[model samples]
Target: IVLDRSGSMAFAHDEVAKNGSPAAAPPGWKMGHAVPKDARWLDTVAAVNGFLDIMDDSSHDERVSLSTYSDKSKADVKLTSDYTEIRAAMNTHSRKFKGGATNIGSGILAGGKTLGDKELARSWASRVLIVMSDGIHNTGTEPVPAAQQVANEQIMIFTVTFSDEANIQEMEKVAVSGGGQHFHAKDSQQLAEAFRKIAKSLPTLITF
Candidate 1:
């Protein structure tokens, strides 16, 4: 799972509840973003943990690596089935730098490297890369071309725009280039449902 940890993500997703918002809201708020300045990273992390839950409920059994980017990209967890590791990484990362320009290209490149041939050699194992962001790529390399390269390798890329600040057009390009779909979620409900759909879309193991 590729996550965006830039400072802009600290902005409040205070929009009203919608039709398909995440079934579970964060502890405090009934519906909306639950992030304080010092606790600014909770909004995205809450949705992500929910996404992780959906994955756990699914039939697929595979380790998921997390790649986060702001001004630069970093791999938090190598490949691990332990959901706790991903959560720990998020909790630890929340305390890190929360300000920087969004460098989406860096995130994509890191994800590709982390999940390249060595990490994903099973031909039968369908590969998918999910890129979520709340803003446009304003730093580092261009993400479109990088996404194209990953697509060339047959890795499906699903792009998500979680806020109105995100560049829908560019994210759409990335999804199309990577041979996948683009999703937009202005509020928590839509965000939760987006993850649920992605989980459902993953390649499932068939039994004879």
Candidate 2:
């Protein structure tokens, strides 16, 4: 999974009822009198955790890696079946994921490199790289060319655009070049559902 840790991710999502508060709105107020907006990072984390849970329930053996990009890219996890490790990296306050330019292409390249390294050792596994971004690519390598290069190696790349501010058209082109699909998420619920769909679609491609 490639995640965007750009500064814009610190922006807020639609308001939701706070913990311990009733889910249903009172009478006139939406979400029970305008609670604080959930940060995009928080919602992304929750959606990712939900995705991990669904993947864990699958019968096929699957391994996942994590890559985050801002002004640069770093592979946080490398092809592990231990989902908790991925969860912890997002949940913990150890690494503050804030402030940086959105380098979407760098993230994709990092993910492709990680998958390529593992492919040499595990040729039997079907590799898929899922890249999620909440902002436009302003620095680093060009995403479409990078994605095409990876696709030429027979690795599928899925692109996901989160929030209205995301560049859906550009990401859709990336997905097409990479021989995969693109998903757009307008809100938190849709984000979770998008992950669900991606996870559920993998079993067919997975080889034992």
Candidate 3:
């Protein structure tokens, strides 16, 4: 999974903040409510955690990798069945989500590299890359070309445009280039449902 942790992800779903806008500190003593100030980011984390749970309950033999991008990209975990490791990396990265540019291409490339690593990957397993972004790509390599490069290597890319301002057109093209599907989620519930649907559809790919 390639998740966007860019600066703009710190805003509400309807509020499209600039690329470098300062992130509000996570809710604490200063805020009466326990929920974090960044509603969109909170929803994203919840949806991802929910995705993990659904995947765990499934019968498919799946290995998952995590890559998060801001101004840069980092592959937090290599492809593995150990979902706990992915969660740990995700939580650690969440704390550092202060603010940065969105580099969707970097995130996609990072995820593809991990899945493409023959040494770490199972030869018989299906390869899929899920790229979820909440803002426009403001930096790094062009995403569609990156998707093509990965798809050429047999890695299918699924994209999730997580807000009203997310680049739906560009993401749709990326999904097409990668030979997968594009899903748009305007709210948290839909976001979780999208992940659920993606997870459920994966095991059937080889049969088709």
Q: Which structure among the candidates has the greatest TM-score?
A: 3
Sort the predicted structures by lDDT, highest score first.
3, 2, 1
Preferred candidate (TM-score higher): 1 or 3: 3
Name the candidate that leads on lDDT.
3
TM-score of each: 0.82, 0.84, 0.89
At residue 179, what lDDT does model 3 achieve?
84
C-alpha lDDT of residue 15 in model 1 = 34
In candidate 3, what are the lDDT values of residues 1-208, reduced to their tens digit? 9998876677778776654332454424222223245657778888888889988997876788999898899998998889999888866655555557889999999999999788889877778999999989989988999999998888888999998989999999999998889999998899999988888788765331
Candidate 1 minimal-lDDT segment of 10 residues: 16-25
The global C-alpha lDDT for each of the candidates, from Candidate 1 onward, is 0.73, 0.76, 0.82
Candidate 1's TM-score reads 0.82
Model 2 superposed RMSD (Cα) = 7.2
Candidate 3 clashes between residue pairs 3 or more apart in a chain or in different chains: none
What tens-digit string does per-residue lDDT give for candidate 1 at 95-147? 55345678998898788776674754456666788888888798997989989
**Candidate 3 to truth, TM:** 0.89
Judged by whole-model lDDT over C-alpha atoms, candidate 2 comes out at 0.76
